[model samples]
Target chain A: MEKNQILSVAISGLLALGLAGTANAADNKPEMEKCFGIAKAGMNDCSGSKSSHSCAGQASKNNDPMDFVAVPKGTCNKIANGSLTDGGGVVKKAM
Target chain B: MPASKYTFPCVAGIGLRAPHYREVLETLPELGWVEVHSENFFGGGAPLHTLRKVREHYPVSLHGVGMGLASATPLDEKHLSDLSQLCNDIQPVAVSEHLCWNAATGFVINDLLPFPYTREALDHVTRRVTQVQEKLKRQLLVENLSSYISFSQSEMTEGDFLAELTQRSGCGILFDVENLYVNVRNLGVDAEAFIKTIPADAVKEYHLAGFSERDGCLVDTHNHPVYNEVWDLYEHVLKHLGPRPTLIEWDTDIPALPELLNEAAKAQLIIEQCHD
Candidate 1:
């Protein structure tokens, strides 16, 4: 085989490997869903049920049952004392 | 890597929230550009879909509210990765984050919180800013924060901190006029002094939002329209720093699409008057 042909084959192999690695990384990401009443004070992803506040980081109280955190979809209900519905569970005030 | 090729005209724009996405896209409003909080679209779904459609019509600036650049904790790799992916997908005209710490130790605060502006904090922020810029391959604009409280620790002013951060991190300034005004009223910060200290050339964008007062302290709430006082201050900014891409941000109780556009028009008029 020609030297150039060998070099081309090696480069193609590395490119294939890099592409596969990226695909694996993308596949590894867990499915995430917003879990309310899980976010601590100042930790909510965005505004909760409160109509007074318009955007993120406006939780007036710690773990206000309205606030939410992005957790693995199925895992939200599984987390100890975690509630998926806003204001459904006991409010865990921020420590 | 050379400061993302994306750029916006030196005009006024609006922060496109979820509620107005459909209207803005359908109507194709006449405006300079539009911005959205980066975190809102971090995940793929309707938000990203709407943003993609909006991008076809106007320039989009990805303004971040959760990067927490100065957080004492290490930079959030996952958050940075998500942002990088979004930037690649959207190819935003400009990207920005606040110069505040949202998380500390183990707790992550959703709001932009103030921190002591000491040399130690400056070093920490500079490193994080550089990391973000490298990841996005663009000049990330760092915005000033509106604080409800002040730290008594030894340090410099927020303006001085931002100036030095820009110098050290090769980042640009977002120049939130409303935030500066909030600080001026709530914290007694000198807005004019701040304008002088910052390098005007590095100010890539300006943010104009409304504030609400609580217990004699002004809160950076975007529900109301830009007040006359903030507009007056904006004129001073345009005069001193020159006109840049300005945005009207109304997050709380966002009114109709026309109202938002009207606010942008007001900013546009001011921007035009400055040039004339």
Candidate 2:
């Protein structure tokens, strides 16, 4: 093959591999949903709700409907007898 | 209900926190068992995966910090279910919660708070404990609280309250020696009297943690090493209650794995001496 053609083919192969890698990365991202009103004080996943404390086990109040933890994407609302807030729960708020 | 299949060894364990998870799992240190804050593993994924791995090498005890057993909010069912699921998953050697309230009418304080030791409160706590025991289908060890405040309407000492709760609810006691010391220092509780009041067999586990003094009040911070005074108190407890599964808990400002193991070694020495 011509040198330029060979170079173009190699670049195209690398570009295709890069795109496939990106798609695989996207596929690897686990589907997660935010479970709210279940975290005990100071036990929330992160500082998504309160202002006073910015770390785990630092929630200012218990069952702060605003504080949440990430669960499997669709399992939050399906938790039997689980408590959650509006807007499809805190996951959307967090996003 | 059948008793929990798991039994903790009468040796020294450590509170398994995040910072030490990797090293503890990798090195498999010479420890009795490890306890994790149940809430930390409630959501699943990496935390639960690590716990599963840790479970393979160690007998894990699910120490819950968020059950709010004394809360007046009718016990969060989801919370109980989540804990039940965790219990089924981990099958820990023991499960325990504090003898304090964290939620009340309309608000929940994340910190453990002292409640009035009234007959009404007793009834409330007993029912809640029974409910928890029913859900877990195993005896729950209730730990005494280290409080900074006391209610004016308290009708009984914390020790008496715990003893009665055990008798009425069929639960076990997780005697936290440091918490007793903190109460003695901050609330003027008589440590010896507290020890004498509790029934010995009821104490299935013991927690030894460090405390700090803030404005002359002792705080169960679990940051520093177990203090001399607390160790002295633990010796007294060992004499009365005999050796139990003692755990060295360090939550905040967590030290390296060796430092925690060293603390655990000290507890192991004390426990062995008691056994001898």
Candidate 3:
């Protein structure tokens, strides 16, 4: 086939993929919280405010104030020192 | 024609990172070819889509950093399979991995930690390279690593190990010139001997990058432009090994596309001079 024909196929494929992605997003999306000040060393979700973990799971100590542990939306506050904010404020985003 | 028909052009290219993807695709600059960290595109959404677009204009080389070929632990089958899938998708001009290890035992180290140049390590790495080659059904270019330390336990020099590795595994060499420079400066590696020991014919590519110095050790940080000393060293390498597809690798603090192309131009000029 010619160039335009090949491109049409690719365009159609991308459209279908995009549509499927939209449907999946409408169906389900995970809601987790970046609960700061609760992650044990080496178990943080990602690099912290101070970058305790450059690579994932490279944190050096337990409950590092800078590190975070991503938890369920409503579950962060119940755990001690677990703040939804980077450095916790009273105004929290919707769970 | 299929993209698979493209081969890495013997000129200068840059390490295509995420930051400049938009600009590169928009401008479609005249790059000799582009190399990318294989792990970065494994996710296969926007990254892979952009790469497909990039492949239309340039020959792409899939350079892997996480294979951990010399790692003592068993090979990561999943990683190999992902790479094979990527090769199938992209039909890259060349597929290469570093001659270093990242995983050991239960932990996965993010950095390309060095290993001893022992006979045992060679045998292990050779077997792993053969396995990767078989799986990919293509020749894999194993890059020499930049190390700050050396092992005194046993065995030969790195160049010797790489020479034997190529002979045994039927693989090619991605000689990172700056890595050798770092070893020479930091660990007192013999530069002339290294230049001589690597079978020139086995060398399929060359890498030039700038390094950072902390205290006294030279770190293989590909952020800055190719240093004057490294350019001098590369000139020496070209006199011996001749020229191949050379790359300008800048991972951090990536400048604009023109700046990168300017760096590539320097390599292109040197490559042209060497050709003359």
Candidate 4:
């Protein structure tokens, strides 16, 4: 019921929600958003394909390669070869 | 909180990254101090939890990667508040951020980008620095950033800008030697002139990191070992600026803890020589 404590709680909630909003604002940026969307779609299209490298490689060329923060080439190779599969599900391949 | 509890050893330190965190905590290796990216610990999770444990053994410095001080955009109150909260929680020995911008008019680069060092830019940056210091209620050590490009409109050099900011805002300096070296080679910035301009007394800490060559420019990657040339420059700085709490920062392609400690040990040797 203290004024300062109430103010602190309100501020904390704002910051927590602000982070998600910031991320959304970041997504609204044209090049970054377009690249990420193309890359995500490319990932989905080639999600479980054993030859995901060809798709990923093409997608990476068309999409924003910098979006994923340096994906190991080995992981991409594994995804392409189907060795990186999960149990009865596929982790979408992205760089 | 007794400030002495987080007393920084007047020697060299290294950046504490995830790869080397466990070994550092488990072994409790002899390090003068350690710096971590402030943004990483903004959210209360495993990373922030780990920082609390690390703080117990080593004198921790929170180095921020974001909070674009020189950006034309309005200051991010949320980011500053988060940083302030973290500082309160950890009670770090030192807190630092770079003199670069990430956000602009409706655009966020997410990487540190250089702007024209014009008078307008200087005014913008100085105001932001004051706001940050006032919000934190602590003297922030602003680190110089490395840039790949330069603007023709630049009036004052980055060093001079920092000097003026320090004079105006009463903030301390966290001079990154690698960034200065990178600027010298890439932007044809006069490193010696930079050293001359900055107020030596304002400098509270030094950062030594590695730069990688990219397209005829040195990038502040901090992924490789400290270069021989940068070490020489650090010695030059130590000689003129006098010994300050130094740190070895390696962010990308981070090696083992011993390797980082080895780098810090190299800096320590220089610090010792400076003292003698």
User: Top DockQ: which candidate number?
Assistant: 1
Task: Summarize candidate 1's per-residue lDDT along B93-182 as a digit string, tens digits.
Answer: 999999988898989877788899999999899999999999999899999888888899948999999999999999999999998898
User: How would you encode candidate 2's per-residue C-alpha lDDT over A1-95 as one tens digit per residue?
Assistant: 99999999988887887778764466575533222222224554522222221012221223545556655566556665344444344253343
Per-residue lDDT value at B256 in model 1:
83
Model 2 misplaced stretches (Cα beyond 4 Å): A1-95, B1-5
Model 2 TM-score (2 dp): 0.75
Of 2 and 3, the candidate ahead on DockQ is 3
lDDT of 3 by residue, B144-225 (tens): 9888788887489999999999999999999999999999999999999999999999999999887788768788877689
For model 3 the local lDDT of residue A91 reads 44
Candidate 3's DockQ is 0.05
Q: Fnat for model 4?
A: 0.00
Best candidate, TM-score-wise? 3
Checking candidate 4 for backbone clashes, the offending pairs are: A50-A80
Clashing residue pairs in all predictions, respectively, total: 2, 3, 0, 1
DockQ of candidates 1 onward, in order?
0.06, 0.04, 0.05, 0.03
lDDT (tens digit, per residue) of candidate 2 on B1-276 = 122236678888898776566567667777788888888778677667778878888889998877887787889899899999999999999999988877988998876777899999999999999999999999999999888899999999999999999999999999999888888888899998999999999999999988777658676778789999889889989998899989998876778789999999999899999988
For every model in order, the fraction of real contacts preserved is 0.06, 0.00, 0.00, 0.00
How much is B237 displaced in model 3, in angstroms?
0.3
Could you tell me which 10 consecutive residues in candidate 1 chain A have the lowest summed lDDT?
Answer: A31-40
